[model samples]
Target: MSLPLYPEPVMEGPHGPPAADGPVNILLVDDRPDKLLALQAILADLGEHLVLAHSGTEALRCLLKQEFALILLDVSMPILDGFETAALIRQRQQSARTPIIFVSAVSDSETHVSRGYSLGAVDYILTPIVPEVLRAKVMFFVDLFKKTQQLKRQAEERAQLFREQAARAEAEASERRAAFLAEVSQALMTPLEVEEILAMVANLTVPQLADVCLVDRVTDVGTIRLVAWRGSPAGPVPLPELIADLDPIPLDSDFLVAKAFRTGKVQLLGEVPRFLDEISPRCDTGERCNRLVRLGTRSAILVPVVRGQAVEAVLTFAVVKAARVYVPADIGLAESLARSVVMAWERACLYQAAQEARREAEAANRAKDRFIAMLSHELRTPLTPILFSASTLAADPTLPEIIRDDLQIISRNAELEARLIDDLLDITRITQGKLNLSSTLTDAHRLVLSALDVCADGVQRKNLVLTVDLRADSHMLNADEARLQQVFWNLLKNAIKFTPTGGEIQVRSFNPDARRICIQVADSGTGITAEMLPRIFEPFERGQETSSEGLGLGLAISRPIVEMHSGVISAQSAGIGRGATFTVELPVVSIPMETGAAGPSSGEGGDSDAHRLRQPRILVVDDHADTLNVMQRLLQRLGYAVSTADGVESAMSLATGEAFDLVISDLGLQDGTGHELIQRLQWSGKRIPSIAVSGYGMKEDIAQSDQAGFAAHLTKPVSSQLLKATIERLLALQ
Candidate 1:
């Protein structure tokens, strides 16, 4: 806590000053002039400038006007005693600490003598003083005082020299900075590569120009790319080449860079821009606003580099190093340097652009790579549960009844995996313009009912009271009804998920106008916060909630899909915990019923599941005992005589030894995907319908299954109805 104040002092044997060389100032105080005269002659051996006083009051008056290093006083005096008089001499601030010695005829006891010492007296003398001892003590303190004064004077002199040196250094620093900047201006027009220029600027620009140097440029896609930066890497990472290749941001946008280039004027930002597009992360404007600015990047200026009447680029400098507002000097040099860099860039535009393009592409490719990696990781999360269940079942058919429960989990997760895969595929299709819509004139109400039916199981699981309000006289719409069903189902499914248990969800539909029908799904769930509401539709962006179980691509995909069908889906919420409403408006037209004509109908009974029965000879192979028993029970219940086996060897032996119409085998067996069984059956020249069943439903897994000659691809815990139907459908087709 304490800084060094002085060097440590060393001690040496005392050496007194020569008395005959000069007279030193000495103080003499007594109640009587006779006593002063008596004390003065006693110390005459030591030369002294005697300051004499007849009383304590006169002595104080004498000490105040002059500096005295020594004082000799009587032990007894009037008004203030000798002890008090000596203390008074020391109390004068200037002479308060002057060494004082007591000289008296009284034989004082220890207590009385101690009182004299306590009053700042250095020595006590008897009535008749011993001249040698008195002179030695006075002379010793005198020489020490003079030596102290000499050292004090020297310290002051050195401190004065230091001040002068510091002032000169500061003045020189200013001149050198000015000269450096002037020299840089001369070097500016030199044709140096960007790296060399950046390195030079990054290293030297601080005192002359900016504390932070950042290059913001337009990307090829017309999005602004933060590029090549020096100082504060905490802001968005910049990709320089991408910025170089980008098209200038739109003039209408709220980016300061755009404003600077548009008017060929420098636009200084003191606060975040007010436009929603500039502030919203969902805007896709790709411009940074307040968040970065708040983190020490306030008071930025965007200076345009103009040539002729066109603005080719913009350079921005913001205060980032300190909290103080930037002064004109801070950005003055940066603006000058920007002009030179712009000149070099423009002259080399034709040659440098191709290289810049490759760089921009590489940067964007990296962004896409990051996006894909996140997507793959998210998609794989569900696959882990499914993959494990299938492999566990295949490896040991002797599993407990719990395997049946795990199977259901696998099927649900598989469905979720399918949806995520669909989203990824949609991304590719969107970029390539390969999206296809299957349109038909279908009952709009029918689709809503179907969505509800698909989501009914999930709704019940959450214990929600699901209600559908349909205006039932049927309106038809020219739409991709199946896809619309999916969109509605996803929304309803999400509502059910976020809704607390025992909450209510209402699905309502009505013709709002001649051109559109409004279908709404309202849920009593934790409503989206104000911040998250706008961006809920951005692909793979999980807003606000850290605990949300989703890839965040659902609404993003759903929104576009709905729009693709010439409909719009929009959401509304007050705030978190207040619930939310989603409405889809699809175009519909009223159609008149045709006058009765007989319709062809010659099917079996209405109450029969018989229309869907193929009665295929089924075999279910899994390692788990519970799965084998459960599948055996489930398959028999579906009216198919079924056989079950666990492990690759058992499955292969059964597969080769007996004929099967359908083989439902787990992909991960004791050894591997039921490939062994497939190989055995093929070797015997007995080809049977096969369904590769497993919990792993990743894109790679589905592809692998297809490559391995699977007839139907299924993930475990597939609903009993789906399992029966898939098998029956395959047999019916055969």
Candidate 2:
């Protein structure tokens, strides 16, 4: 006979009822086909999968392929009996828990029945099987199996849902942590006062991270002080009134804040009352602790703000609402917030220090400017007389050529001394970034020649060979003439000083492009070393030639002057003995259509015949006796009726008594300044044309003189011809 095949079971749909466990398989074993057929018919009323096996071995094979709710076994079989098959089925894990019932025909003895039951059988029946009992037993086991599968599925679903909820909660916590740190970082980055920073720190931690916040700072006297605190606005009492009675306490007490500071670590208390009592017995009676308990304090954290090895302050946070509690993770966050506060405090201190330093530096700079002005005035006063007398005597025709030449030398040296003083002032202006340029359309070639002329004495003294090349077609520039000449003079002077006797010096000018002009001053002198070449333009830097003649400010001053005119200056040298070349590049401009007429030439005294014809009465005032005497002789020789005074009072007396055509007054007078004298004379209705002659030649000084009603302001060490021309112009203007 052929065994029947069974179809695979269908799974229940997702929306099926809870009790709908679908179908289950049942296995039946009998050696006789008739008995198997009988059992299948008996269980046909119950709707479930029924698998039929002919022999015990066939039954075990059916158990291997599918799970069954119940197994029906016949005791009498061919090769493997019902008891042996049942033992083997129980040995296999899948069929071990399956309910088994034995069906027997002739094994009616008590011993045989006991043997059938010992083989893991649930029931034993005789040859004429009871159909109703068998059907009821199979249905009972099928229902139990379906219910067990349903419980297993429901448990798995619940576990998965719990995992999803945990993952979402953790992600939200991480997002909140990131946002809080970002807020703290932004708030602490700006410059603020120390107390304000502490207060900000305390205010930032409330409601979100804690219900209350307090900050304690370590004082310089080894004590703790309550610097800043904040309480929740939702608390029972008003925030201001709640903390009104709070005060700083000594660190000797064993409070959490003090303990955190002493150990330089965080102190945490999950159970506030118990831990408080353990740490300090007096905490139970302390007002602060009593207040915290009244507010329903649940947990607290104290983090120390440590800078290096020292504790600078302590931060306290408490959960007073009882809904939240502090955890280990919160300790890390508290420490981070504390660190931000410490960094902000340090930045504020540094900012304050920087402000103080800037003020001190500005004051020092002002003092330096004043000292330079005064020193310039004092140094220039003496040279005025020397320059005046030398120029006067040198102009006399009766003197021998040698004597006249000697006077010229004295005058030239005095002028040289004056230029040195100007350099000192120029360097100071350059460093302060206040150097102003008076730009005009000028010929670079002319300024180069003038600079060469200024250095002619030194060149001739050394008997050096000089070479000049002016090949540039475009050499005109809008620049400061005097300052440009000063740059060229510095380069040539350095070349002259470093070069030995009979050395060669070459100066060249050429157009590098249609828009730019280049000038090179090369000398066969003691060349600069490679090491010093980089810093050659630094202030007070000199070559290693052992020459101590200058202050080493020439190159330093030259670089900036050239740059100010939209130009570049550089130096190149082959080696120590190979000579050096300095090159300057400047932007050229188109020459103007017309050049203004040149002013009256310096060093040419006024027309004596015209002055003698007018006999202009002039009053000269100076505090220096030699300066006054020189002015008197110089003016007298120019054919003017000159009167001299050594002070402002004498000058005023002379001015008021005589009808003067012009007044010349020194700025630094015994009784008053030239500015005062000029103002006084004008106030007294003496409308005489005045010239202010002073050693203070700064731009401010000249401006002050102009404001005082002086027609002109002249720096001291003025040449005789310049003074003479100035007086003639003023008198002519009157």
Candidate 3:
């Protein structure tokens, strides 16, 4: 009624089975203990599990506890004998498939053996069983049981090993995904220019994602450029062999790159060598297709790098070293990388454009400086004769009243024009920090009155009400008197020019504080707007209401002049249509009295016949005949012996034959330059005093003239007073 107890399953270890471990059970059933003992003794050396049962009921219980190799039963049991027990064992599903061997003393009859056999007994042993035969038969069953159990254990170990391998593989794949994304992020972090970025990206992708990679970009000229190319170590083909090296992909072409760019999509080509004609139908020679085949290219993908809606570049990858089929994952990675490259390229383009713009602005500034210098030289040339002739006529007592008045008008206007030209030249010099200033103790109030005198005509012409208030007690300031007067005149004239008819102009100067002098010029004229107020002092900047006649350099030049004197100039206005006020403040400092007497304004020389006899010989060279004649007459009037030449050759010829005391040569001759004329004169073994007179009067021009051994450099239209002064000084030094 109860099952036999059994120990836990005995497992085979790596070394050997433990002492208590054994094979599957072999159940021996009998009513007598001696018979069961005798059976166990026969199979004891088999090292198998032997579950003993003295009755058929016990044997059925043993079958419930453990699987058996075989069962030995006796038909001579009192109740539940071998045949009945075997039949009962068969009825139980767990032991139904188990082998059963029946042992009996009275089962020699055919009917009895048939009954036992019918109950699923594999064998029936009679009385007086042979020991050797029984042991051998039981050993065979024991060996079979051991092998079956061993097979089950081996199968379990294999299943566990497979699970571990699958887990390890999954972990490796996750790491690779992380590493791939990290590498791409690093590449984007340290960006080179577009060219270097493209090349680095191509190299990074090769031998990992693809056997070959090519990155192409669209140039500014609507052409494709091969930005970068790379191939795996095993497939060492030249990059030019790839279609990326071909001419720009035409928009109308059927080539893979063209198709991808045109549609702005990814294109996949399988069996690339064979399908080349299908994709690129215009391949007349098949040379490209054949080459790809030889290189083992089986597949490729052309991906367009799209930024917004426009395709900016293309990325091409091929499996050349080995045959491979690409999947969607590969295309996705390439697309991501292309986007990064596009961003880098756009940034690089902006950087390059900014650099180019900066260069252009610098070039424009340099040209502006040069133009100002040239303008100064040309405008000064013709004004010289007018000033000199006006001075000469004014000095003559026999001149008529009308003629003298006309001569005074010419002289005043020429001097005014010269001042305007000098303003322009000063602007250039100020911006370049080359303007030279000579500071002297000057009367500030007197300078303002002088500036007012200069602006009186313009004020009266406009019929404007002008008022002046000079309230400053300490008016003396150590400054360049000429330059300071120029500044004051510019401010006064600007007020007169801007004021309308009958409008009021006020000029006020006072000491705002003990250490500062403030000069304010206010005009009831077109006032500055808020928009134009900030940039009003900038060169060439003008208000909307002003005319474009003058170069708008008045306030631009005035501000620098004040600042150079340790002063500040500012403007205040209510708005347009209201009056505007400009104020200049200069730092007040103690003035030091000059110790030496001032030099004479002009050198002493007589125009008498006796003085003419000793006058120095002067040689004047110019390419213009009219200019040469005027210069000759002007020099002769100044009591100098003058010789004129129209060009460098004549000048050189004249100098060779004559013993001139001074050589005044014009630069830029028709035949050659004035430098050549001077060089020829110097080569003649004479230390002749020379002056460079020309339309080139830039600082660099002056420096070059000094280097060329000239005693002085003068711009054209030189005033007779200045020319005579320079000649007298040079002759005196000589």
Candidate 4:
């Protein structure tokens, strides 16, 4: 077998900086200057810094001042021999690793050679040394030191460049974030309209945050809507032309946008495969993918716009101009932008909803007011004549005793019917916040007694046992006395109505503390169930015990009245079949002693100033003939000259012909509204004092009446006494 030919080994110099500039140092230590001069002349071709020391002590002093690439010394010396000097040189930090060569005259002895090597000598040359060998060894170490310094310099330069690039990148990233947030904020301030906002977002982010952007939203019907899109700036056509052929991706589909929406997570694709067929097996989707690839889309991120736990939309970012990869920090910023978009969309939706609701509420209220007014007119028109005829018949003294008794019954039932109607109207006023309290310092105990007296007939009819304990002596409260009496009456009436025959109903009034007076009504009645206890005070909350026929508004009305007086009312019961206790607490206060007649009770008759005044002319306007006739007779009986009209046209005719001191008109007349009639009267230069009567007595209705120049507002089923008082008051004002 033939041996394979191999190239000769190359002899390379030690790697280092070029010797033409700063040369490396080599030390020569010898007692004889002639030998040093000889050694220097032979090694001068090496081009290195040569250092000389005459003795071992001189060599030690040289090593202390500077470093050397290599050290040369003669072994024989007078004081401080080469071995001791070399050992001391090794002890110093700067010259510890320097290479040393020893010269000797004697032939090589194993002991001498071993001792020189043991003293950290690199080489032991005999006398009559070859200069070529000396020069070659010295040059090798010098090259290594120079090469290390060069490498260190290159590393430092590279590090400075890297730091500069990093600082520039950080500054650019900060600027981009600031610009993005500022543009988005400006877009939000434009208008809350969703379409415009989405368009602004899509266009604003393109070529800045992304090369291309698309925004898609999911509709209420589970259908997707493409809000906005921006193609790459490199495209031959504009952004609209690029997106014109595209369609909304359905949420149930397997597209990346839909995936982000359904999963409510971020989807980042660093490299979208060039082949469309790999993305989808379907031919149609493959074609769409081909178009996107042609648009130069190489990378993408689909971030979901999350509102609460649900994903509302998806924001798509594509890099078309350059292939890019998103880092964790980039993804975090993308999600933050998605949050801003979600907030804008939600705020727009809420604003639209609030506007719609406001419009609907206003329309519904107008219709409700109209309905209540019409219904009141229809019901009260017939009741007016019934009440007036009964009153008129009962006042006739010449009638038979039996007939008089029957007439009395008719009058009583008619009055009772009117009272129920008034209760309904009161509930409407209280619920609509139209009722105002005329608060005064009054006796709570007297009001409680008065409420009991009103409920006396019902208690007797039911044969229910009643007990009274009025222990709150002179308990005066700053409250609406009439409203308080209504509260007391409601609780007592409920007890009488629900209690079985021979059942006990106890009414107790006492001061729980110095600041509060409490009234307790305990009854052995059909108790409220556990389920009903929580909602017992709610309006029309008649529980499963449905034996009652009345509208369940008594407790509902009582609660707000008590609350208006800074008081509280509560009910307690064990369960069904157990008795129930109702407690009402009102604040107690001091009042000055009085020696005169107390004020008349609410909804009661009183001496009027109208009786002292000359007979005043009055006009009654209503569409219902029965109402007109009844009102005319009642007012005439009160010694007023009264005129009646059936409609606005007729009323205007009568008003223009007659000089009336006061005008009382139904709000909803068949011809026109009372507001129109009053406006017409005012326009005609008439300043007659007017009162508005209607069942649509909400707060807004009263405000409208006041705005129309009506002096007072009264709901239908007005009492004869209340009407008389109102008429007298208006006449006095005139």
Best by TM-score: 2
Write one digit per residue (lDDT tens) for candidate 3, span 286-385.
5434434444567787889887789877888778655455656556666766776777777767777887898998799779877776677667767766
**Per-prediction TM-score, please?**
0.39, 0.71, 0.55, 0.60
Tens-place lDDT digits, model 2, residues 1-734: 01101112233234323545577888888888888888889988887888999988888888878888888888888799988888899899878878888888875657667987787778777867678877777788788877777776666655555556556566666667667878887888774688888888887777667777877887877677778877763457765666665555557756567777889999887778676576465544645464355545778888888877888778888877644567787787788788888788889888889888999999999888888988998999999999999988987999999998899889988988888888888899899997889999988998999999989988998999999998888888999998999999999998998888999999999987889999999999899999999999998888784845777889999999999999999999998988999999999997754557788777444554455566899888888999989889888888788898888788888887898988898998888898888888988999888888887887778889999998998887788888988887877555
On lDDT, the stronger of 1 and 3 is 3
For model 4, the stretches where C-alpha displacement exceeds 4 angstroms are 1-145, 164-191, 195-339, 399-442, 459-466, 500-504, 524-532, 542-548, 573-579, 590-615
Estimate candidate 1's alpha-carbon lDDT, on a 0 to 1 scale. 0.66
Number of clashing residue pairs in every model?
Answer: 21, 0, 3, 0
lDDT, candidates in the order shown: 0.66, 0.82, 0.75, 0.77
Report the C-alpha displacement of residue 224, candidate 4, in angstroms: 20
Off by over 4 Å in 2: 1-142, 220-224, 230-237, 267-286, 290-300, 318-322, 349-381, 395-398, 428-434, 452-471, 495-508, 522-548, 571-581, 591-734
Candidate 4 or 1, higher TM-score: 4
The stretch of ten residues in a row with the least summed lDDT in candidate 4 is: 1-10
CA deviation > 4 Å runs, candidate 1: 1-441, 454-467, 472-482, 497-504, 539-551, 576-578, 588-616, 621-633, 636-655, 666-687, 694-710
lDDT of 1 at 37: 77
Better of 1 and 2 by lDDT: 2
